[model samples]
Target chain A: MHTDVVHNEQSMTPHPAGSARHPQAGGRSPRRMTPARRREHLINTALRLYSQQSLEDVSIDDIVTTADVSRALFYRYFTNIRDVHVAALSTVVDELIGRLTLPPDGDFRQQLHHTLAEFVTFVETYATSYTALLRSGSTIATSTTDTLVDRVRDHVVDLFRERLGHSSSSPMLERTLRGWIAVVETTLLSWLQHTDLPREQLETWLTDQLLAMITTTAQHDPTAAEQIRHLLAESGDEP
Target chain B: MHTDVVHNEQSMTPHPAGSARHPQAGGRSPRRMTPARRREHLINTALRLYSQQSLEDVSIDDIVTTADVSRALFYRYFTNIRDVHVAALSTVVDELIGRLTLPPDGDFRQQLHHTLAEFVTFVETYATSYTALLRSGSTIATSTTDTLVDRVRDHVVDLFRERLGHSSSSPMLERTLRGWIAVVETTLLSWLQHTDLPREQLETWLTDQLLAMITTTAQHDPTAAEQIRHLLAESGDEP
Candidate 1:
């Protein structure tokens, strides 16, 4: 998730003559964007459109027109529409990682409650883009470094590690986290389509789901499960 | 896994024209197909192309050309290319359900080992089509009755219910099965892309993972878990 497709697009942007930022030209009615800024502009433009529409339904022309940039300018930064989506998707992944981190406050369940709510909000905000990413067989290419999904998996793992006061996690633990996160992702996607369920109930449902999986994973991998069981026991000790 | 979409497609075939049992036409060269057989022919044609290429890469022109049908005739059944893909996808789902039925075996673990091996074979046979369906937000439309994914979920849930000697399972049991199945589905999709792992090892890994999830879910919902625990104890008694 913390990777380079976006940077690649930035590198690809043609350094057009007038697009360079100039202090002297800044006083003009319309300011020229620096090449880097133009690339960011295009990514943001693409992301905004993607947040509301399906990838199949979205057009390159729709993106460029909304950005008020010519096709030539759009082509300078992205060779294909998928490039723009890839860039936007990486950005969403970054935002997701940031929001998912939890405070060392409440008990394990409390922390989960807090984190799941934030997770749900992020999905709601980027439902369109998130849907688009999930629709791709590889949200971010598997060949590409660790996946954006892996990034989310890491966030959940870090919380478990932190809660358990463990320096490292087992492969079984990692697989459990990966599987649990996939469930959360799939369930959230299903929930997005069916919003009839109230928000609190949905949050409770997600929290229960995560807790249930952790409780289950523990039975198979007792060492890791023991750590979590101890953590829950200790969380009760805190207050 | 016991479901209706595939059966529904089979039933929808019109018993029209000479396509109906043409015992006499059997000797005729290039004999006319009944409406049901013609639909089946087109679906088979589409499935063949889908097996080799991504859905977007396959064209309506490609389907008709492969089937040797004109554009007008193609419209006689399918509304568009997606329609053909959906029909073909349902057929694949039926094949999957048929292959996944469990046999009375050594133990629960032994039965799962047998089922997982068959499941992997089905995916290996239909890798391209499976990939295409997973790329869709829902493998089968969530709105359109029970999905192919849901069908798999039912298979797991039914096994659990039967093994436990329960007439019905809890809500949590159902959710756990749904989530575990999603994990299995996600893992299989990933495993398909990275085939370095040996098939037997992959099957063992998947079986273990499913067992782990069930164990964990049981810990949380002890009513269902107790039933499984007792079943395992009795399986020991059997031998």
Candidate 2:
């Protein structure tokens, strides 16, 4: 389950040349290109170029030419083309993560399903760029992935911690959250690699796995059984 | 958890060129370097150089100078420096996988702990090289990671399938294996990154997580429960 690959895809496209071309050359009454607008233009152009070819196949020259920006301006805004790609990816990830709503009051299974479904849809919709980003594996790309994983880990850990209350620090709860995140990342990556699996089927499969990790007593203390039950119920699970 | 990082460290180091370098610059009777020996030389030199500097910081000239190999020979052996690094990585991963011994008759908990400990130790030993290997998100690096992952996944899945006596096509069992692998990989990676935790402590934590995932019934059907029980029993756990 290599979610790293999914994150990787978003980080690797759009060679830095596009961003480098942003600043007006030989500034004679230079038209001011706002940073935000320049970024958008670069990303949109890069996406279009990335969709048509491999990341390695695309050069910085190609992106600058496509985006109609000066090399100096591009550098002014981005450290490199990879940075631009990562910035684009960060936007997508932020959007995707935002969409993953953990209802303050839904069954853990349902919540897991919703989250997985949303993630799968995002990856599928952006498959080409995603794959390109993953294949690139630049420092910026990896850092973006690390950021995503860290954010997701913190989110899931918080959810479990909230449910577990004071017992949140318990090793068992920590293990459970970590295990679920691991499975989720892996399942997402596998699905991305092999998109033949129906979204619902993948979601259902992941939901069951996550629910089992949360509810089972393999590593949980015997005393926490009731607590687990109460937490599950609060999350809308009957059992 | 980024066990990928650990694996990356073990394989990316290039051999020391000082020992391998030929004294004379002029081609005085070129020593016939076997493909295997040449690969070893390249890996060792690359790892050594990469350790001192970033991947981008290191050049092909640096590697060739250190390896005492002709540029043409280097090309013959690898598409680029990254290719050499990946090959080095694959070798280390294959070795680690080979060393993993799953006791046929230990308790489920014990077997898991034993395997997890072995894996952690392998990663810790090669931590530096793995860091170098995975630092960049190049296509070659990602592909190398995929190959390493596929190898580990195949080995673990086969081990579990044999224990469960499940057909290769069993969806439930397959998912179970994949989930377990995901959890393990994630935990290991986390452990690698978080130096605050002791290796033994981290391994124990990971073992507990893996046991919870395997012993739980999230992905398996009731019919498969018996097989799970058998697995536990074979591992010396009373089901």
Candidate 3:
């Protein structure tokens, strides 16, 4: 499980221009851009490398070489590899949250289905980094990175609450929602590793898992049953 | 979220004999014990300290002083604090696995309830260290420690498989079980932080949560439906 792929750092030979490693390859030309644009470019370079491999495998040298910038410039923008990793992951979290909006006027099932689809697409897009960011005991694991992951989970829970139109959820309802969220995360992590089932099946199964949790919770807690009765009614799920 | 309660390391004063910190306290008298016994003593000392606070808060000095041993002796038995922490947690994992046995001749629901009761008891006994071990990105988090945590999860899954009498489970059944296991973990972690619900309710809700997952999976996968038919039937659950 601790198989961190270490790229060869002894070799100083840069990839040829236009190669896959250096997508925006240039022949050592003095291309000029504003400081903000340059910082974003560096972050983008780090993200592209993260896409190919775990954050533990990417290094400062890799980032600078791929960005076609000096080590000094890289340090000037970000203090270390972890700094850039956090910034890049924060960007990913922002993109994910921005893409997860429900229109608030559709059937509950359809809205949940669409939201889960978008979430799945985001996870697929950032598979490697998503795995690295969530995997416990990674060398690059930090409090900030963990907080970013929590932010995503909290966002999903808040979205669920908003859709249910409840000012405050009963304890049973909250725990049921949180428990379902954990199931989704663990299932997605496993799916990313094996992908034994089709993506649509995974999506639909996760949706069903949440509804199942809510239904089961309702059986035990009258408050939850009362609060989510309308939810079951709206979705035509007689539980 | 990263509030690691650091103890005052500068205070080298050891607790009085027979105090809580040193259950086997002695008044500076050289005690005789075998090498294996000595190592076990050190491990127990770490566990005692862990029960009082998170692993992050306990230090080498704390362990040595509490155990009534010199720093040199502490080093002789273990490499460092993390070495002792890992050994202590492995002891916990062993105890948890040993206690989670299900009688092979009882009703499935009763068996599950008994096993979950034992699990809840163990978690309550080792609340602080269990939380620390499962929390992501802790300062003391290591691949070895993380593997110990995984060992517990794998043991639980194996127990389920044995009880289900399946030589090999279908993909849907395995995934459903794993996802429910995650829910149990997350729900317990939250429950530990806030004891808002009764312990019996927690155990029963978790049992129902697994049944719910299995039932929902059955609706989508015929293989799972066929595999768990006897399980649901024996438990007198229509779904």
Predicted structure with the largest TM-score when compared to the true one: 3
**Candidate 1 per-residue C-alpha lDDT over B100-133 given as tens digits, one digit per residue, 9 for 90 to 100:** 7668766777877887788777777677666656
Each model's DockQ score: 0.14, 0.25, 0.64
Mind giving the per-residue lDDT tens digits that candidate 2 earns over A79-171? 877776666666666666676666665666666666667767666666656565543253334656656546756766775666566635555
Rank all candidate structures by their DockQ, best first, as comma-separated numbers. Answer: 3, 2, 1
lDDT of 1: 0.63
Cα deviation of A26 in candidate 1 (Å)?
Answer: 22
Give candidate 2's root-mean-square deviation (CA, Å).
11.5
Candidate 2 at residue A21, lDDT?
A: 40
TM-score of chain A of each: 0.77, 0.68, 0.86
Best by lDDT: 3
In terms of lDDT, the poorest run of 10 residues in model 2 chain A is A1-10
Which is superior by lDDT, 1 or 2?
A: 1
Residue B176 lDDT in candidate 2? 64
TM-score against native, each model: 0.57, 0.64, 0.89
- CA lDDT, every prediction? 0.63, 0.59, 0.79
**What's the ranking of the predictions by lDDT, best on top?**
3, 1, 2
What would the per-residue lDDT of candidate 2 be over residues B1-239, giving only the tens digit for each residue? 21221111233333332434433223332345456655665666675565555544567788788656679878887897667667666766777787777886666677767777787766666655555444334334565566675787788777667656665534554666787776766555555676655766566656654544555542345554666776566554332
What is the Å distance of residue A229 in model 2 from its true position?
6.6
Worst 10 residues of 1 chain B by lDDT: B1-10
lDDT of each residue in B81-122, candidate 3, tens digit only = 889888888877877787788876777788888888888887
